[model samples]
Target: MNRKVTIIASNGNLFDAYKVFNIAAAAGASDDEVAIFFTFDGLNLIHKDLHQHLPVPAGKKHDLERFKKANVPSIPEMLQMIQEMNVKLIACQMSMNVMNVKKEDLVDGVDVGGAATFLDFAENADVSLTF
Candidate 1:
């Protein structure tokens, strides 16, 4: 059987969220099944309109320019890369309701679910991480 990993993202911080996806993608590439559950402010990661807006790292000088110049992946690009690698991205339906975000507003391929749904994935995961 394949390994299973679940990542729960609750904060909206860009760096942390980026790390979660990066790790998950690496695990998936190793033949593990990875699922990322976005809740609370983390749901912003899936919002179609907001996905492309990369947050600037605080106290970092010229970091954005360096990243751009090096062709580092943007948040949206990272998300797309995860999807292309078959990593599942799930957005919390309850959070979306509270945020007044519609299904159409989420990025393509996002699976919408509630707490129980995420818990199911967690139950079967060999490794679980909460961000």
Candidate 2:
């Protein structure tokens, strides 16, 4: 039987974003049903303009080169891959209001909703994670 995976993405840093996307992608590729809830600064991951330009954590600018050398996929590329793999991306409604982000600010195929929406998907999740 396929497992249900739910993820909460609450960090805005590039490193965290990379980890979340990578894990989500892997789970989806394994035929698990995956859902990512973007809250607080995590909403940046689904934003069209911001997702590609996320910053490394403070004083970690040097890691950019390391990521490149490791052949890490770009944020946009991962987003595309996850979408193609049928991963569900949800943006927090309250976070969007606080950040002044509109539905149009997100990439295509992202669902915009509140905590209840995510909880509905997460309630019976076989695996739950936070980033």
Candidate 3:
């Protein structure tokens, strides 16, 4: 059966971005309704420029190389894949205001909204995760 999956991403690191995308992609591929709520640092994952060059946390440089060598999809590639799968990508409006992020700075097709919006989507989620 199809399920509802909600993910909360509040981290800025590459690892967290990978985790969030991996989970969302998996759920979406399984025909789940996936929504990712990006708040705080997590918003970096959806930032058009930042997402293309997400920073690897110190000491994890080797892991990044490994992922690349293993042919792990790039952040932009994963975003495209998920978008094609129709996953919901929401950028937290409050976080944007506090962080000085503008809608134009985000990738195309992302919805800009507040907590109530995310909560409303997550309300019936069969799986909810934070990364």
- Name the TM-score of candidate 2: 0.97
Q: Which lDDT tens digits does candidate 2 get at residues 1-131?
A: 57999999999879889999999999988999999999999998988999989978889998889989999999999999999999999999999999899999899999989999999999999999999
For model 2, name the residue pairs that clash. none
lDDT of 3 by residue, 41-126 (tens): 99999998999888899977889779989999998999899999999999999999999999999999999999999999989889
Q: Pairing residues by index, what is the TM-score of model 3?
A: 0.97
TM-scores, all candidates, are 0.88, 0.97, 0.97
| Candidate lDDT values, in order | 0.83, 0.94, 0.94
* Full-model lDDT, candidate 3: 0.94
User: Tens-digit lDDT track for model 1 on 13-115?
Assistant: 6676677878887887888899999988888777787767745558764766886898867887788888988898889988999999888999889899988
Clash tally, candidates in order: 0, 0, 0
Which of 1 and 3 is ahead in TM-score? Answer: 3
